[model samples]
Target: MTTTPARRRALVVRGGWDGHKPVEATDMFVPFLEDSGFDVRIEDSNAVYADREEMDRTDLIVQCVTMSEISPEALAGLIGAVERGTGLAGWHGGIADSYRNSSDYLQLIGGQFVTHPARHPDQREGGEADNFLCYTVDVTDLGRTHEIMSGVEDFTLRTEQYWVLTDDLNDVLATTTHPVQPYHPWHRPVTTPAVWTRAWGKGRVFVATPGHSLPVLRDTSVRTIIERGMLWASRTASE
Candidate 1:
């Protein structure tokens, strides 16, 4: 008799601000997760966090909620689940920008989105420059050997470069530098993590800061990193 492998269960909780296009963003990745052998369940409401039984059975949680308040009961359930080994992964403001009022949530995530300095648009008519800045993402030496970042190399990206407030516990995989432009107050370039991973209790946490827009998320390199990061966080190998 042949033995069947147990399907990994994933719960994607989306919806907070429509600006993040949480529904559309979650739609983009659901198929990938399904193809990766996960039995995926999606909830447009954060209320799902209150279901301790469901949370306990879940193997992974992919959250796309941005700037929303999670109820105390639900928050406790989610935190307890992750602490007990349910993996968590998210990109951009979904994880970092959510739950601004909860210090415990911020500590669990290991970072928070502070700001993205806007670039000055050229006064010249049709000059082609806007707040979106172009920068390079360089993989760190440690990242070169990590499963999530192994094949990814230094690449240039034109998008919102996030200035995040991070903790020392993160295992940084890649980084980008923010140049001192006239639009910003800083006199010197500020370097920040573009991709990183950390452990929360027995669960793994993964974050990437480049997915502000659909096009950015669709970028080949960005997509690859997120896909790999998700698998790594879930403690699964791609099929």
Candidate 2:
């Protein structure tokens, strides 16, 4: 008798601050995942993390929660699931900036969004700003060979270039430089990772920092990179 291959499962947990357009961003990729042969489950609550059984069976988790609090039980379940081999992938503050109070979450993701410097008249010593700027994302030599960056090339984007606090463990794929501006304190260009991957136990972790809005996310190169990253993170055979 012939048998069909079981489709991989993906859980997308979205919703924190609406400013990130979690619904819109997640919506952009849901059909892609479904078309790529994944059984996709969408959730707006972090409570999904508390369901250990569900997490255990999931092949990948794409989260877009920004600056939200995750309960201890839910946090533990999320962490444990990734550590035990379920993939985790996200972009912008959704993953990097989410759960600011959870150190375990930070360590798992390998980075945290600290600030996105902007040109403002009254910018104080250490104040944050939301100004957008034009920058180029250069794919690293290592990235050139990585599956997630296969067809991606160096490209320019106008968005909030995130300045993140990162760990050495990340396998950086692409990077961008923050040029010195009058409103900024730094005198020289500061290079930051634009896309990267790291491992949490047997699971893979992928992050792309340029998805600040749907337009940015829809950029040809940006969209391609994210789609590839998602597949790579899930360890998809076709990736």
Candidate 3:
């Protein structure tokens, strides 16, 4: 007799800053996860992280919360879960800009959002659109061969180009350059990781710095990368 295979479980935790539109952003991917044969569960709070019983059963985590505070217990549970083999994947501020207070979280993800320098002089008054700029995302040599980035040519975007602080631990897949302009104080052009992955024990982590808005997320290349990333980061039930 043949036995049925168990469906993989995906936990989506989203909330925090409204500017990132966490709800709408995450909603875009739920259908994809379902189609991919995942048993998807979504929570608006990070408090779910502390539920070790659920976390232990999770195969992948898709987080979209931005600038939110996670309790110590929940944070610890999250770290423990990932270290134990639960995959983590997110984009833009949803992952990079969330939990600023936790250095441990930063260490796990291997990157953090610093700022997005405004491109237009007239629009530099702190609105979201002020930082929008036209830039190219160049794939790295390693990216040319990696499963997540292979065959994906360098692409350009007219959106927020994130200036992120990252470490050498990340396996960077693509990068975008922040050009030096007279309006910004920085003297030299800064090139930051646009997409990357990290290996945390048995779990995998995937992050892309381009999903600042729905339009950006909807970009053909961006959407493809994120979809690939979620699949790549998910843990197999047998594993």
Query: What Cα-based lDDT does every candidate model obtain?
Result: 0.86, 0.89, 0.92
Positional deviation of residue 45's Cα in model 2 after best superposition, in angstroms: 0.9
Off by over 4 Å in 2: 120-130, 235-239
Alpha carbon lDDT at 88, candidate 1: 91
Tell how far residue 104 is off in model 3, in angstroms.
0.6
Worst 10-residue lDDT window for candidate 3 reads: 119-128
lDDT of model 1 at position 170:
98
By TM-score, the better pick of 2 and 3 is 3
Best by TM-score: 3
TM-score of 1: 0.93
Candidate 1 lDDT tens digits, 105-150: 8988898989876667554244323546788998999889899988
Local accuracy of candidate 3 as per-residue lDDT tens digits, 1-239: 99877789999999999988899999999999999989999999999999999999999999998998999999998999999999999999999999999999999999999998776587677677788889999999988999998689999998888899999999999999988788778899889999999999989999999998899999999999999999999888667
Q: Where does candidate 3 stray beyond 4 Å?
A: 1-3, 123-126
State the lDDT at 160 in candidate 3. 84
State the lDDT of candidate 2 residue by residue for 1-239, as single tens digits: 99887899999999998989999999999999999989999999989999989998898899999999999999999988888888899999899899999999999988899888775666434522346777899999999999899878899987888898897999999998888887778989989898999988878999999888899999999899989888888845443
Most accurate candidate by lDDT: 3
Candidate 1 ranges beyond 4 A from true positions: 121-130, 235-239
